[model samples]
Every structure is written in structure tokens, then in C-alpha cells.
Target: MPAAANLAVMDIPTPQEALRKLLLERLRPLVETPGRAQKPCGMQFRGTQLFSYCCFTTERIAAFETLQAVIGIVLNGTKEFWVGNSGRRFSAGQVFVLPAGTKLDVVNIPDDRRGRYEALIVEVHHLPPALAALPELPQPAARETRHDVTLTAELVDALSHAAHTLASSDHAEILAEHRLAEVLMLLRNDPAARCLFDLSLRERIARMVVAETTRTWTAEAIAAKLGMGASTLRRHLTQDGTALREVLATARMQIARGMLERGEANVSTAAEAAGYASRSHFIRRYRSIYGAVPSEHLAR
Candidate 1:
């Protein structure tokens, strides 16, 4: 077949594309108004799983540090990302997976027709039991990269069901988890998303701590939460070369830094948001990690 003919043939909307259209339509009620706020805004689904609706009125570039792994689907417009030194682009009908603790900048460009950029950001904290029980994935080299994959019908359907159930009932957490699990299981089979499946113990703990940054987390408490002995959890984290204290600090700092950057809170407010009681202590710790006071972010 001729190249032009192939393009014509492929231009037809796949079943996935059709379902994505319906999903976006169903989500319109929950969509935030563009330009109302600079920060991403949306709803939280199940525990630690967030399905945020991000809408930007104008072309905007922002830096983000992920505290948990995210699966983002662009519902409108396009996104260009720079991870480390590599660049990648994804438009409507595409999916991108970012691992926990990744620092990257992205430019969100609205399509001329829509005049706004829209996307759904799903924070995936941990794999479901079915996926977790599978064979462990090989650890890749220490490099920052984003996984790009074609959005599938199964994922769209799962999201649609999850959204509908949440909107209709007060007790929808269990049903929503099963639906989102289907979404994750689909991603697990994709080669590009294999990195997401290999979240380290340190990363998993980091994700959990960040969810409730205000809590005073002890090793025993965290271990009990994870269904393991305190000493055993400590040993495993030690093998990963990160201690519980360090992980907790890193997670809290990330939250404070993010809030400051978004202009949502001042140093004192951000410190409290990150679970700090004393302003001076938060400032000292912030300076130690970022080499600047929390006030510096406010200055921007």
C-alpha cells in the first residue's frame, strides 16, 4: 500500500480512541477551569491514588518532581517532555508513565481548536497483588526516562467505570481499586512500562510516607503497615542503601518544595504541610537538601 493510503487507513479512530472520547465527555463535569489556578487540580480516588484533571488555558511549561509513579493520559492538546537530556512528545490518545522520584520539565500546549490543554494524572502507588506476585522485573541502569505507550481500550473502559462508580456512590473505593487495577495490569504487559513495574523498596516506602506527611512515622509503625517486622524492613531498606529516616525526610522535603513552587503556601505553611512543627528546623533541613532556604522558591 502507498504511504498516503496507509495514513488514510490509520486515520480512522480505533476502538480505543472512541472510548477515550467518551471518557473525556464523562469527565467534563469534574474538569477544572483553565487559568483559574497554576497548579494541577482534580479529585482523589482511592487511598493514595489520585486522578487529577489538569487543564491549562495557555501554553505552559512547568517543572515537576514525582513523589510517586504516575500514569498520565493526554485528553486534549500535546505535551513535550524533557527527562534528563532526552526529549519526547505525546499528543491526544497517548499515554506516558513516569517513575517515582523523577525530575522533569514539560510544556503543555493547547490545541488551537480547544484553546486549553487537558489531561488525567493517575498516581499509582503500588501494583495490585496479582501484578506484585509476578516475576520481578530486571532493574535498569540509573537513568531518567519516561515510558510512552499507546493508550488502549481496556484502560479507557476501566477509567470510565471507575469514574462513574465514584460519582454515583459514597462507598466506591473497593470497586474503584479493581477497575484501576485493570488499568495497571494492562500497562504491566507493555515493554515500555516495564520500568514502572520495578519500583524499588525505597521508592515504595517514599510513596507511602508522602501520602500522609504530617504523621510521625516510626520504623515499627511503618513496618506494621507494610506487614513486616521493623528490623526486617530496616534491613531491606539498608540493602537498598537508604535508611527510613532519610526516606522520610526526602518525602517531606519534596512536598514542601512542591507547595512552595506552586505558590500555594509560604515557608511556614509549607513546612507545616510537610509535617514540620518548627519553622527553623524545616528551614535548616530544606537548605541542607536544596542548598537554599524555602523562601527562595517563594521568590520565584
Candidate 2:
């Protein structure tokens, strides 16, 4: 892969490609100076569809969590998946089906060959029309809401192909939708997967926040739009372990990071979209979350 500025869609990294590069970078890690972005890895995301993308991991990480339902494919290496005190180890080719707001601790064990741990994770935003219209998934004798999903061989293959082609394909979003549709097919057949689709109102609010990052949203305003009182909405978010501001920032950061990763916008434009009046402020916050200022992508 060339410098990010020189690399077009053709040079974007697939999951496997990402893993390889991450390992190589680790051998000669770039030093991160204060107030400057780290050296850019050729690890560009192909698109901002929000429904799909690839993620690269090179070191051990823990306390991984987010507010999006994700379908994750383990491209290489085994990783420990911990839900509370109980823990389990899963290896390459296994899939992680996690509902929104579920918290899991993960520790990556790099494969000796690649020296990287990679997973391509696709976030499920609003329910696609296909899944929304789907009847509830089947139920076992003992019923419970599902929090995680198991991967099947067919799903693994489809998602692997999606990651492989995503970096080079012009139709990244389309490929993602196709893969997501396959996920929906799986969900339709499995009651456990479908149960994750019972997205909570708090999650709904979070999606709305993500969708409308530019809007100056307050709890009162959101409640008004949702036909509820401000205090009630606050209580709901509190129960979900978030607040109006936190949700707003989380949503804005996702969109902002996507815009930067796809090379869709410079830092200034992304700042505006994130509802910040100051580019410097946005950069500081962006660096805090992403470990780099956004503009550094072009410098690479």
C-alpha cells in the first residue's frame, strides 16, 4: 500500500491485508509525539455506509464495547472473549454476533505467521427492511433474549469475501448490504439472532443521534420528537449507561471517523458535521478517541 494520499480505493486494505501490514508496522512502530497524529497506516476504510467495514488489531486489547449490533468475522488468530467473570477462547473462522450495548472484554492473540489479530465487523444500524419485516425468530423451550450470536460456516465464507473485496471494490456499500442481507437470512432462520433485533428504545435514540449528528440535540428536544418528556428520556438513557451528550458525541465520532477514514472530508468539514464550531477542538477530541488528529491521514 502507498501513502494514504496516493492510494485510491485500490490500495485500501482487506482484513487479511490489514493483519499483515499491522504486524509489519509493529516491527517498526512509529513513535507518537504529543499533539501530532501517529504515522498513518495504509489502513483506510473503503466507504462510510456504517453497515459494514473491516477492523485491524495488532496487540492485546480489553474492555471492548460499543452501542451497535455487530457481526464480526475472525480473519486470523484466536482471541479470548469474556462476558463478565466467565470467559472463553475462540479462534480464527469463528464469528461474533453481538447485540447493541452488550459489553465484552477481548484479548487478542496474534497468529505467529501474521503477528496480527484481525476481525471485520459490520455494524447493524437501522433494521433493514428485510429484517424488520421478518417474523420473530424461533424460540427454544426456555426463552431468553439473545445477547450474542454464533457463526456458521456459510456466514464466515460470505463475510470473508466481503472483507476481501471491500478494500478494492467500487461498490463497497453494495457488497456490505449484500452481506448484511445474508446476515438477515441467518437471523430469519435463527431465533437467537433475531432476538438481538429487539433493539431497545435507548438504542433507537442512539441511532437517531448518529443519524442526525449535525442537529443541536438536547434531551428535551429529542423527547419532544419522540413524544416523551425530557426527564423521562434522561432516565431512559441513564438506565442504558449513557447520557444525551455521551450519545451525541459517540454518534458524531462514528460519522466523523468514517468520513476521515474514507477520505471523504478534511478535519474542518468533519468538525462541522460533528457539531463543533472549532476545528482545533474537534481535532483534540478526535485524537483522544482515535489516537491521532484527523488531518494526518493526508500527510501519510
For every model shown, the clashing-pair count is: 0, 0
Q: List lDDT for all candidates, in order.
A: 0.70, 0.60
Q: Highest lDDT: which candidate?
A: 1
Best candidate per TM-score, number?
Answer: 1
> Tens digit of lDDT per residue, candidate 2, span 184-291?
676555555654566666666666666455677788887876668999998988888887788777677767766765567888888987878998898899889767
Model 2's C-alpha root-mean-square deviation from the true structure amounts to 13.6
lDDT of 2 at 228: 80
Colliding residue pairs in candidate 1: none
Using Cα atoms with residue i matched to residue i, what is each candidate's TM-score against the true structure?
A: 0.73, 0.54
lDDT of 1 by residue, 12-127 (tens): 77775676676677655554456754545333332325455445455445565675677776777888888667778877767788887777887787777866677767666566
Q: Which stretches in model 1 have alpha-carbon errors above 4 Å?
A: 1-11, 14-29, 32-63, 128-135, 138-146, 164-169, 172-176, 212-216, 224-228, 257-266, 273-275, 295-300
